[model samples]
Target: MKLRTWGFYFAEAWRGVVGNGLMSFASASTVALSLVALAAIVILGANLEHMTRMLEAQVQVVGYLKPDFDRRWSDLLVQKVRAIPHVTDVRFVTKEEALDRLRSELGPDSVLLQAAEDTSNPLPDTIEVWVDKPSQIPGVVRAMRESVTSLDSVDYQQEVVSRLAALTRAVRLAGAGFIALLLLAALFIIANTIRLTVFARRREIGIMKLVGATNGFIRWPFLLEGMLLGFVGSALAAAAAWAGYRWLAAQVALGLPFMPILRPDRVLLPLSEALVAFGVALGGAGSLLSLRRFLRV
Candidate 1:
């Protein structure tokens, strides 16, 4: 493809867009709306995935010891627990450390903290256990109870882990289906718009064929036109998505500072590039599909 040939394709594509301004606007607007929903889903899925990772990193099992439990076996117990499957390591939290933690949780002026300071600490020794994965919690907890004696209780956030896993799967599956539907609708509208443009230019197409122009030559301008339509829509969608996500992130930061969400600056650049590429691909696909029947001559 020479520069002049490319220039001609761009010129013709531009002419098509300008000649059928209403139809072009309709196609682009529909594409933008469809892509905006896709952007929302992508951003949401990203944040959910980030949160899941954070939780996974922090997830651990804690075992409380009975007050009468012997402290002499602490090192031996650590060794026995480390030998358990999926148990990475274990640590002993003495009553003093546990009291300090309690105070931290209850705050400096807390009545409970003042009383604990004045009276002998009744906080039990705690065993902090780390596992390789969240799924191993149940089995590991059971093993802990069986292997260790005078165990007060075994505690882990297995429910939280399970719920987050379920939610992430559901969001991704639903989002994927919805995105597919939106893309199909966008393709249908763009194809119809391109088909109309092709119909109006049928005479020119025939003349080009008569002059020995290849089907490729007749197709290039319409292909470019379709792509241009997608380009405009995707750009608009990306801009809107970036702005919306940035504002939402800021609001989340102010209202729910503990919540973990990706910064727009980190997320938007790649997201926008992906949307533009996806839009252009869809445009090319719509152009190809629409022209398949019309190119028989």
Candidate 2:
């Protein structure tokens, strides 16, 4: 389309809003509330995903070597385990290294450290495998036990791993459901808003139909109006959600010093862009459906 044609469409859409100020406000408010709920869900899903990842990162499977195993066998085991698809890192912790770690954990003032140093260090050399996915650990452990001969036993936190897996699955399901409901709500709000606006201008539409105006020409302004309403509402919603996310981040930082809350900044721009696309798509869809059903001329 030409620039002037585009400009005219925009002006007509703007005029529609100006002509029905109250209806416009109502439509914009509806869009804003629906988008705000969607934004909250996105933020919540993001945090849950991050927390799950942190927990997964901390989980590892340790394969302890037999007491008389040669150092070369331990190296061989580390290399074989590292070949696993989701394995991120594999480290061999020697008996002396384990004892040193235990000593550091028990401070110099600890009598336990002295007693530990005096006795024969019972800690065995082990290969610790860090995996990218919690689900991969069980398979990797099984494969290592079958393939590697020097390893005595594999140990992992079964309860923690199981719970993490369950939590991840539930969060994903809930997130999908929330997003689907929010989109449906947005569609209903926009369609009803357009219907009311069209109803208020029924006489004008009747006269236009009686005259030479085609359906497309009559439809352009209302469609553009819906688009504009959605865009503005989504912008406001994004701002509100961003403010809330920042405030929540501050509280998290103060409350739990150990947990690292990801800065929402990383996802803000992408999320904003997604919202704009969503608004445009929803607005266009709602306008088309409403006009087709109600504006029969």
Candidate 3:
């Protein structure tokens, strides 16, 4: 299209928006609200996923050796555990080191160590196993149990691992469902708003058709109008989401310094861009759908 024609289309689109001010505002507000909700879910899901991964990375399988096990086999056992396919590293903690760790954990004045000092250390030698991935931990634990005959017990917190996996999956599924519902609601609202605009302009569209205006010509203005509405709403929503997320992140940092929260820069930029794109696409789609029946004339 020529520049003049494009300008005319945009001008008509602006007039449409101005003509139905209340409807346009409603449409835009709906889009904005939907996007805000979507952004919240995305941010929450990302943080939950991060926490899950952090927990997974910290998972370790510890195997305790038989109480009377000879010290001569410790080095060999460590080397063998390290050789396992998914095992990243294995370290043997001697009874002395274990006792020291207990004392440190118990604090400087704890008499628990003093009472045990005269007696042989009751703590068994332990093999600390680290895996390349959390998923490999179970297999590594099983392999260690089967291959190491001297192992008296193994501890990997199986229940915790299973619960974390289940929680992550549930969060992801719930997020997906909620996002889909919000998008659908936005689409319906925008489409209905554009339909109203089309209905109001039915006579003008018919007149244009009689005057040899192509369907494309009749469609462009409404499409642009819908896109403008979506753009405005999305911009507002993105701004709100960014500001809210930043404030929340600051509060979380202040309240829970040890918890790992996603930084705004890492999340907000991409989220803003996505919201903008979604808004434009949604607006265009709504306009296109609403214009079809009118264009059929």
Q: Backbone clash tally for model 1?
A: 0
Who wins the TM-score comparison? Answer: 1
Model 1 Cα lDDT, one tens digit per residue, 112-203 = 88888788897889898988999998999999999998789988987886788788889989999998999999998889888988988888
| lDDT (Cα, tens digit) per residue for candidate 2, span 186-295 | 78777877787688777777888999677887788789988988888888888888888888888888777666567879767778888877787788777787899766
- Alpha-carbon TM-score of each model against the true structure: 0.87, 0.73, 0.79
Span of ten consecutive residues with least summed lDDT in model 1: 51-60
Error of 3 at 35 (Å): 1.5
Order the numbered candidates by lDDT, best leading: 1, 3, 2
lDDT of 3 by residue, 8-108 (tens): 99998998898889989999998999899888888887887787677666638889999888999989998888888988878899989999998886766
Lowest summed lDDT over 10 consecutive residues: which window, candidate 3?
Answer: 50-59
Deviation in Å, model 3, residue 11 alpha carbon: 1.3
Ranking by TM-score: 1, 3, 2
